[model samples]
Target: MTVELRVLPPLLVSLAVTVVLAACTRVPPPPPPESREGFPERGARLIQQYGCGGCHTVPRVPRAEGLVGPPLTRFGARSYIAGELPNNAENLRRWIQDPQSVEPGTAMPDLGVSETDARDIAAYLFTLE
Candidate 1:
């Protein structure tokens, strides 16, 4: 005995292909660049990638209303770093490079930000004024 398989109609096949092609043709929107001084576009990307908003409140980044850590809105204007070290670029760099070194047992961990990224993040944080 011989068996025959039914084939889908050509019109249905073409319509399915058209629907798939249209779905695949979608384009994603480009990221918005940070226009603030010191906080370059790259730094903003890094901040989002590093999950900074998971713990701290970062301006402009949506869903960054976390309160696990201190609000960074006034980090630049703060008089002291970690409530002990003086606030400055150098000190901020040190803190970002290794938070545990500056304050052992602190809940904050160093996210391994490079010197350049640290400066940019700090610049953005400072602009929170």
Candidate 2:
């Protein structure tokens, strides 16, 4: 009733280890394309008003070094939203406006962001690069 892994050679064991380590490592996604839809400056102010820094570690904004959520250092260069939705102006805006609609039970609460505010916030996020 004893199981033996001797059937697997040393080289196979090394290969398996290497594969597992590689899988555990995370590779940053390709940056999203640039666009000229929302206003970045306005978005920055809105970020402060929305208090997004309380959870996410956002750059530039004072006292925004929160560790509750992921750091938004190079958010503009990311390829996905909430690690699910495609990174685009519209999707970003939607997520900012109503995070609950995008992901149920997500820690990112819906802050009742107005459409205009969402657009501005998205614009500011895209400037993080």
Alpha carbon lDDT of residue 29, candidate 1? Answer: 30
Q: Which predicted model would earn the best lDDT?
A: 2
Each prediction's total of clashing residue pairs, residues at least 3 apart in sequence or on different chains, is 0, 0
The C-alpha stretches of model 2 lying farther than 4 A from their native spots are: 1-31
Question: What range of 10 consecutive residues in model 2 has the weakest lDDT sum?
Answer: 1-10
Query: What overall lDDT goes with each candidate model?
Result: 0.70, 0.84
RMSD of each: 16.6, 7.9
Tens digit per residue, CA lDDT, model 2, 54-85 = 99888988778778889999998889899889
Q: What is candidate 1's lDDT per residue for 1-129, written digit by digit as tens?
A: 122223446667889999999999957533222223346456556677778889888877666777988877756566666876766667766787789999998888888888888877766665554
User: Which residue pairs in candidate 1 have backbone atoms (N, alpha carbon, C) closer than 3 angstroms, thus clashing?
Assistant: none
Question: Residue 128, candidate 1: how far off, in angstroms?
Answer: 1.2
